[model samples]
Target: MSWRFVSLPPQDGYHMVTSFVSVADYVSRGGRNTLLVFSVKEPFVNVGVHQEVWLEVDLDYTSKAGIPVVRRDLGGGTVVITRGEHDYFVVVNQDEAPSDPKALYAKYLSPVVEVLRDYGLNAQLKDQDIVVNGKKISGNGAMTHGKAVVLAGNILMKLDVDLMSKCIRVPTEKFRDKMAKDMSEWLTSLERELGYVPPREELDKKLKASFERNLGIKFEDSSLTSEEIEEWERLAREKMEEEWIYYKDRRHPELRTERCVKISSSVAICHVDYKARKLLRITAKFLGGKLAEVSISGDFFVMSPKGFIELLEERLTNLSPEDIPKEIDRVFEEKKPTIFGFTADDLKKAFLEIVNKPEVREVI
Candidate 1:
């Protein structure tokens, strides 16, 4: 059946979040139909559901700048969304969507890649992020809500690097400066790449056309049903509270000690940082050309028991550098562990980088 579609009118950040959630519920209840929603809300700082706003965002700056901080139901690092950027949300029945999150991302987000390519950008999905010239151009995440799959992300018309950097509550000014510089280089936008923001109206037309052709589904204009409106109100009241935004993430704290140390030629310790739908930080030590010990820690959501992650790490220890990926793949396949917004491959690549370190550095 054709999916119902809605382009939500621009509203405050809280309304936008609830509207998307409300629409996703349409599929959760045996509706059997999907929903494609496009929304752009007022400028706000949004943090992952698990993240503490005070830890990652500068509350003072956000308050003074009139940018409200919100906690999204999805899991990911903090992000800034402004008025003009495009935010796409796809709500599909789990039975109709790919069972695997990785495949689900590639399937639904392919049209987005097509749109970017049509504009002459070399876009591809790499490490789950949409990248061009090895820099990220779009960010995405996927999660299951009841019987529905919710995929959400943004297409950058332009990015405010200074504001993005200043809004984050990093440890020091030096770190903030570095964060701003890195964002400017590693993150990009359509305006930066094409020299001007494309007409959003035309872009919306292209998106609808591309999705129809790629997903083999028609989109008919639709309105929010009375039931969804009620759900939206309830969710807004529950999800938009200050306590939710400031809730502490129980994941491992930032490693304060040295993360890298060189033991000798071909034997060293290294740390690798990776991101997909969630942050992944890994610490690995190599000895005798094999993994001696490794630890995986981050704010990523793990549905397994508390010790499951440790067991996965233990299963990988002492494996050859080349064999780590295969083992990680096997564990994920057999356990069917759920880490929201990430795949086994995303975790493997992070571990491999440390094992494949090309240069030795002093303790960090």
Candidate 2:
């Protein structure tokens, strides 16, 4: 079988390329060996197939900044990508690939490592990540579609590290200034590692050579067939839809939130510890909601759970008399939870009724 190399121009093109490659590989009976590599414009938060977007992201921040949130069909931790990141996707027949996942990475990413080495950077595969000097520069994930396995990853040519940190919601107190400094020191970009910005075409050529040498296959430059192009457009449109990006699972409610106040979702009941400023303990009673349970144990810290309750009280004081469902829908839209079978508005109304009065303010 001959290998086909298709270079997709950088755009909202990653999803399209993957879909087309999967279709071609399946329809052609593994006869079409293809490499689909593309880049995307604007930063997007791509989550795993099973991840909850709200739990994985700070939606308030992402929405205000105009960043798009995408739930990919693959499984992995959430990844932030921008125009600078170089993305690679490979579609191979499972029959041709070794059964072990590590072997798959070795087969595809070994070429990437070779290309980085050619550029004077010591790049090696560590598990599934491509690391340069022990800091991860690339992360890879894969999923099976029909008879094909699609492996995709991005090379950190240049990353906006600060924006990436902000885009993904990590408990801020966990990383002190000194710890943050130490963490930043570990990350290395291609420009930083190579001492200069390499031309895009040059980088692509290096990758092409690496694959050819490592895989013992020749790559012929090819364009998408008419059927493939049509498929790509259809997939792209589907990806761009809000419903697909936001709520593919029917079990996920429209919105949910975690505050200092005592709030119960259909799945879990949360009680925050005021002194700890984090979740004291969460009891998950149902499985339909995305989050099972969360423990604020160990060294994790946040605004006192009591403080969060006070904030909720203040925010909901004027709405105590409002209709329940209307309030729930409004709050759900505002907070946008991935758990809590009910909406944010519903939680607010329920909490107010449970307390029987607004919470008193206490100075922290």
Candidate 3:
């Protein structure tokens, strides 16, 4: 059967990528082999299945940084992606790929591993992760959409270690410094390792060659059909909405902390706590578009909790209501954690409701 290879414009957020996945799901339901490749404009923190955004990120810090937080339907550790990273999503009917999930990952990733080797990166597939020098460089996840299985991952061609460390919330006292160093040692970028950046087109070509060689298939370059494009736009809009981006589900508030920020919006509530040193609890309520409440909690150590809260409050006062989510996302992006399963949007909604309640609105 002929395979369709469609390259899409760079999508900046999880919602857009997931929208494309919806299109792939539709195509795969019709028994087509679909490969979608796209890039993103900004960096975003993506959580895996069975992970909570609050548990994995430092909301207090992230809300101030303007980073975007997202939760993927697939399962894996949380990952940070910026413009320097390249991502791929492949959707194939079950009959088109191996039935066994493990086998399917191997079959699909063989090409990526080969391509990395050709670039002299010494890339190898270990278990379900793609490793370079025994450190994970690429991680892939698979999910079933209709009758098709979708495989998606990113190649960290170049990443900002300091920024990544600052973007995620981690547990150790020196976690930020340690992660910056560890990531530098564990991950390699084509630009850093080769001392020059490869053109995007060239990289795509190399990946295509590797895919053809390993999968024994020919790919025909194509564009999305009108039907697919229409569907994509519709889905993208829905994904970007508050309902999908935040408050998709509700659960008991698990973690809590207290933080303060100095912003025009007034004393916005800020809460943050840690687990294993990573962000575990994050709640921020805005008062008059300012932070009114900030709480942090979890099974993590925090020396001078009062000091941390005061610092956050000062920062919150400086932030605008619109900046809240970005700030929260930045904290999570810098601080990496195991993640519990809640999403940033989930916490955001809770905080928003708590802080932004209408003058006439009342909590039950």
**How many residue pairs clash per model?**
0, 8, 70
Off by over 4 Å in 1: 249-336, 340-364
lDDT of 3 by residue, 1-364 (tens): 5777778777867554575467565766594586677788777776653344556666666678887777655655567778787778878876676755567779999888887888888788876569887877686767666666778886777768877787777776497788889988887777776787777777788888778788878889988777777777777666556454333122313223244333343433344433222344555555554444444333221211123333443445446666767776665554432232334555455445444444302211
Q: State which candidate, 2 or 3, has the greater lDDT.
A: 3
Listed in order, each prediction's TM-score against the native is 0.73, 0.68, 0.67
Model 2: per-residue lDDT, tens digit, 322-363? Answer: 343354455446654322122244354443332332221110
Question: How much is 1 displaced in model 3, in angstroms?
Answer: 3.0
Quick one: best lDDT, which candidate?
1
Stretch of 10 with least lDDT, candidate 1: 249-258
RMSD of each: 7.1, 12.4, 12.9
* Candidates sorted on lDDT, descending: 1, 3, 2
Locate the minimum summed-lDDT window of 10 residues in model 2: 296-305
Q: After superposition, how far is residue 126 of candidate 2 from its true place, in Å?
A: 0.8
Candidate with better TM-score, 1 vs 2: 1
